[model samples]
Target: MQKQDFYQSLVKQAQALISGERNVIANMANLSALLFTSLEDINWAGFYLVDSPDELVLGPFQGNPACIRIPVGKGVCGTAAHAKETQLVEDVHAFDGHIACDAASNSEIVIPVFKNGEVFAVLDIDSPSLARFDEADRDGLQALVRCFELTLS
Candidate 1:
C-alpha cells in the first residue's frame, strides 16, 4: 500500500481501537502490531512506558526479546523521552551510544508520548535497512503517536 494510504488506515484503526472498550495495553499492542505490519522493512515496533521510579519499563511490543530497562537518556527511545521530540536516526551505529537491542537494526525512529505536556513514554520503531525511514515516516508515525495519546486520557 502507498504510505499515505497506510497512514490513513492506521489512523482509522487507531480511532476504532481507542474508542472500543479494551484496556490501554491491549490498544497499544494492537497499534504496535499494526505499525509493524503496515510499514515495510521493519523489525521492531512497540512502546517503552515510564515507570514509577522514573525509568522506562518495557511495554507492549512485537519483536524479539529486547533490552528490559532503558534509562531516561540512553538510547534512541530514551533520548526521545529526554529530548521530548521525534528522532529519525538513519544509521543506528553512528548514533552516539546507541543501544543495540537488536544488532540487525540499522535504522530507527522514536516518537515521544506526552501527558499534560510531560513526557510519558515513546513509540519506537526499528528497521534492519539503513535509511529505511524518511520524512513521510516521521510525519506518519508522529500522527500515529498523537492518536495513541488521545486514548491515554
Candidate 2:
C-alpha cells in the first residue's frame, strides 16, 4: 500500500480504538499499542506527558523501557512538547541535546498532543532505521492526535 493510504488506515484505526474513551491513559495505552503493532521498522511508540512547565513524565509505551523523565527542550520528545510542534528527526545521533534512552533508536518523530489549546503530552515514536518517518507519517499522526484530542472535551 502507498504511504498515504497506510497512514490514513492507521488514523482510522486509531480513531476506532479510542472513540468514546475519555480516559487519557487508556487512550494513550491503546494508541501506543496500535502504532507499535501497525508501523514497520519502529522500535518504540508511546507518550510523554507534560508533568510540569519543564518536565515530561513517561506514560504508556510499547518497547524497551524508556527514560522515566525528560526535561523540556532537551530531547526530541521534550522539544515537541516545549515548542508545541512536531519534531521529525532523521538521525537521532545528529540531533543536538539528544538523550539516548535506547541506543537502538536511530530516528524519531515526536508530536505534541494538545488539550484545551495547550499541550498535555507528546506522542513519541522511534525507529532503528535512519529516516524512518516522513511527512506522510507526520500529517497522518497529527490527524490521529486530533481524534484523541476530541475525546478530551
Query: Which candidate number maximizes TM-score?
Result: 2
lDDT tens digits, residue span 1-153, model 2: 998898889889988999888888999999999999999999999999999998999999999999999999998999898888999999999999999999999999999999889999999999999999999999988988888889987
Where in model 1 is the C-alpha error above 4 Å?
52-54
**Candidate 2 overall lDDT versus native:** 0.94
Model 2, runs deviating above 4 Å: none
lDDT of 1 by residue, 101-126 (tens): 99899999999988788887899999
Error of 2 at 11 (Å): 1.3
Cα lDDT of all candidates, in order? 0.87, 0.94
Native-to-model Cα distance after best TM-score fit, residue 74 in candidate 1, in Å: 0.8
lDDT of model 2, residue 23: 84
Stretch of 10 with least lDDT, candidate 2:
144-153
